[model samples]
Target: MILNGIITGLIMGGILSLPVLGVAVIYGITGIPNFAIGVIGVFGGFLTWYFLSFNMGIAILVGVVFCFAIGYIIQRILLTPISERGGDSTLFFIVTVSLGFVFEGLMRAIFPRPSISLALPRIGTINIAGVTVEGFKIFALLFALGTLVIIRLLEEHTEIGKSWQATSQNLKLAKLIGIKTNRVFSIASGIGCALACVGAIFWGSLYNLNLMTGWDLGFLGFIIAVVGGIGNIWGGIISALIMGMVMSFSGYLLGGMWQSVILYFIVILVLIVAPKGILGSERSL
Candidate 1:
């Protein structure tokens, strides 16, 4: 039972890490709290489901592309104008939050009915040390990791990645150095939303999905980011795993209701003791 719990926790953590990392990356790069990330993810999942009649891979690809476009357009149309006007972070943050609701409403309108469980195509289950594991869970974990690796590689080897790093480190300095800050912001935001889509794919495969699916997950992702150190991708990933383990164990031992209570407790404890998070710096918040 313990081993099963651990493995399940890891799987859940891996599933969750994508969105947490996305939130971290966007926050790190733009200093804007993208409250709409999860809703975007929800939209992606719904898009995939809508197109499931076609090839699954193609459906996923389309979903990803759609999310990327959404992110890019939002940044280009709304955020860019606001930022250029010297809007405060608080205002931008509220706008992002409002964007989440807007996406949620859009999703609700598009997917009027609750969907049946949309499981991804999978082989079969595997038994490891007397514990039965879903084959798709392993695939989902690998896919998530692969997505992260791809992002890391892009950041390391691509010009866009360099621009992202520069903008993240110092946006004004990046602009001064002739970096196209607006373009970099749009690309980064697009990538972040794409990451959220990846997360939504795995999540939708694992559970019953609905328009509201992203709400709680978004909140959880935010918590994971804060606990792991906001704006730290690696930190968010590690912290998500830890939180996944804790949530799994708590759900098993206490109950579903207690899981949120315990998680919130951990968040409070972490904030009081180490507000910067496990891997975050003094300026992380």
Candidate 2:
């Protein structure tokens, strides 16, 4: 039972951590708390569902590409302009909150208010060290791990990755060196949104999904990012595991609904203790 609990935590945490990873990347670069990410998750999930209703593979491709485009546009049109004024965090927060409501309403208009589950084929079970692991959970973990690897490689290897790293360290300095800060921001935001999309598709396949589903997930992501330290993607993954474990254990004791309240409380406590987060190197705060 103890081994099962640990394995369950590993599986669940891996699957649920993408949004948090996205938040980490975005916050690390833009230094803005993009509250709209939650909406992006739901939007991506629904879009996937809509497309999959026609064809499966195409749905995944379309969902990823569409979310990336949307994220890019938001960064370019809304976030970039506001952020130039230097106090854009406040404005961005307000805008994202408003956008979340708009997304919720739009989703309600487009799809029924009733929950919809993506009917994916069950893969049954896998024998892992004599422990029976749910195939769906294993698949989700593998998907997330693949995304993480791709992201890590992108950040470390390619020219775009170099530019991103340079820009992240010092935006003004990067611009002075001709790194195209605006484009980098757009790319980072796109990647973040894409990550959310991947996360949503996996999550939606496993459970019932709706417009407001991303609400608590978004908060959970933000908390994981904050606790792990923004701007550090690796830290976000670690923090995600811790946060997931906490929530999972709490749910075992209290109830699922209270898990959210517990997360918020943890976030508040973390903020009071280490305002810059656990592994943050930036002096943004």
Candidate 3:
């Protein structure tokens, strides 16, 4: 039983890390702590649900597009001004929080605040080395891995990624070098939002969707990002894996409800010790 629980923990940890990875990448590029990312994700999942009620494949496609649109619009309309005005980072944070609340309110107005699991055919669990795992969960983990690989490739191989790297290193320098830094930031924001939506839909299919689900888990992603060290992929993945294990064990030893509270303490500890994150470095973009 103990071994089984640990295996389960590893699986769940990997699954939860998907969104954190996306959140970390977005923050790395834009320096915007998007509190509304989770909201966007959950909403994407809801969009998937609404559409999948008819066709599964179309639902997934729509969820991806929907998330991308939301992220793109928000970046263009809201954050662009603040970035241009050299506004306070605190102001951006406030705006993001407000945006999250607004999304929650809108969701409440349109749908109930209860868990609404999408109706999809459940794949049978796979027994691996005495441990049983759900096929969908495996698919989710693969999807997350694929997304990470593709993003990494884009960052490494493409001209757009070069611009992103330039912007990430130094916004001013990037602009000076003709990278259209603002547009880069905008595009990165859109990409992050879209990625968050993908994570949302994947998780929503595994569980259910609610307005608050995104925001609630958004904080979790934030914690993982912090632990992983901001803007560091390796750190984020490491921290996310550790977080999953910690939460899983906490749930086993304590209670599921207390897992998050404990996780926060762990994050606080990591921050106090290495303020720049465990694997974070001050590298010029």
Candidate 4:
């Protein structure tokens, strides 16, 4: 039973890390707290589900690319302009939440379904010691970890990634040095939303997706990021793992009602102790 709980916690944490990474990356770079990313991601997840009958690969690609395009366009036309005009974090938060509602309405109107589930293929199962687990769940975990590694490598080796670091560190100085700050922000936003979409895909596959799931995920992701230290990738991952354990054990020992109660209680405690987050932000916003 203990081992089962541990395994469950790890898998849940790994999957949840996807949206946590998304929030971290976006806030880390653009310094914009986009509360809408989860909704946008769910919108893309529904798109993937809609096209699943045709081809899995194509459907996934369509969903991800569509989200990237949406993020790019929104940042380019709306968010960036607002930022340039001296909009603060609070303002961006309000705007992003409004954007989330628009996407949510569009999703309901177009998809015409209040709930959905992705019919992903079963990839067999694996046994760890005496425990058996699904292969797809492992894949989701590894994928999320691999994405972190790739992002780290990108920041270290690539010129574009260097620009991202520079822009993230000091936006005004990056502009002074001839970096396209607006473009950087847009790309970061796009990637963040894309990551969230991928997380949504995995989550919808593992469980059921409903109209409110996006808000749940979006808000959950943000809170996790905050607890882990907003804008800190490593911190976000750590916080997610801790939260996952809390969730698993809470459900195991307590019940569904206590799951969120304990989770939020821990978050509040963490905030009280470390206002910035567990590891603190890489670059304070």
| TM-scores, each model vs. reference | 0.94, 0.92, 0.93, 0.98
Per-residue alpha-carbon lDDT of model 3 for 36-78, expressed as tens digits?
8888777777778877768998998897787777877888788
| Candidate closest to the true structure, highest lDDT | 4
Model 3 misplaced regions, further than 4 Å: 281-285
Model 2 clash count equals 1
Q: Write the per-residue lDDT of candidate 1 for residues 79-166, one digit (tens) a residue.
A: 8788789888799879988999999888877775666355578879989899999999988878777877777788899887888888
Q: Order of all candidates by lDDT, from best down to worst?
A: 4, 1, 2, 3
Off by over 4 Å in 2: 281-285
Angstrom error at residue 276, model 3: 1.6
User: Which number leads on TM-score?
Assistant: 4
**Cα-based lDDT at residue 15, candidate 3:** 65
Once all C-alphas are superposed, what RMSD does model 1 give against the true structure? Answer: 1.9
Comparing 1 with 4 on lDDT, the higher-scoring candidate is 4
Sorting all predicted structures by TM-score, with the top scorer first, yields 4, 1, 3, 2
Clashes per candidate, residues 3 or more apart or on different chains: 0, 1, 1, 0
lDDT of 1: 0.83
The TM-score obtained by model 4 is: 0.98
Under the 3 Å rule for N, CA and C atoms, how many clashes does model 4 have? 0
lDDT of 4: 0.91
Candidate 2: TM-score?
0.92
TM-score winner between 3 and 4, please give it.
4
Residue clash pairs of candidate 2: 28-231
